[model samples]
Target: MSPFKGKTGFKRILNAGGYSLDGLRAAFTGEAAFRQLVLLNVILIPLSFFLNVSRVERALLIAVCLLALIVELLNSAIEAVVDRISLDLHPLSKNAKDMGSAAQFVVLTMIAVVWALILL
Candidate 1:
């Protein structure tokens, strides 16, 4: 039995998977923040398993770490699209980029709080 659902679903899944990989590649290669968060994930996800925590606590620890990466990817995407539209500085573009940065900041703080609560 194949892992994919139906024939058409299988093709769609493959295409979606490829596109997802491309996006990750672009984020990692082009966005330093994305790469830094990936490094944090590479460290934290494995460390979560080793910590003497319950299943739920362990999951929470890992989940917030993943959330940081997800927010960073969105931030990078927003910045990329804004830059693609035009290199010229504009207030709306500044707002868009700043809001994305704010989002990333909140998520990173979330990771810290979650880890601290779980570990301390």
Candidate 2:
């Protein structure tokens, strides 16, 4: 079994929360793309509320924006793990990182489509 796998209950929840916050802090500090998306979220999330849309539409807008952040975090995690394994310019490592980037790009495109449909 994996060494990182076995925590349960309230203690697990607390530990998980701490780990998640640390991941966010690491991503915010280490990834410029993450920082840019976060700044966009800071403006867009609140602006989403004030737009003349139904509650469901507002939620969809906000959710898609947040999804971009989620994808970015996952991408960052993938890159980090790949780098941790080796910094060498291996083809597989490059492919893994590229796939993560493509995932983020797709999510960003989805966010744009959702926002345009709801707001315009």
Q: What tens digits encode model 2's per-residue C-alpha lDDT throughout 12-108?
A: 9999999999999999999999999999899999998789999999899889889989999999999999999999999999999999999998998
Best by lDDT: 2
How do all models score by TM-score? 0.90, 0.93
lDDT tens string, model 1, 23-120? 99999898888889989999999999898999999989989999998899889889989999999999999999999999999998899888888888
What is the lDDT, from 0 to 100, of the residue 68 in candidate 1?
Answer: 91
Q: Would you list the C-alpha lDDT of every candidate in the order shown?
A: 0.91, 0.93
Question: Which regions of candidate 2 are displaced past 4 Å?
Answer: 2-6
* Whole-model alpha-carbon lDDT for candidate 2: 0.93
Model 1 misplacement above 4 A: 1-8
Top of the candidates by TM-score: 2
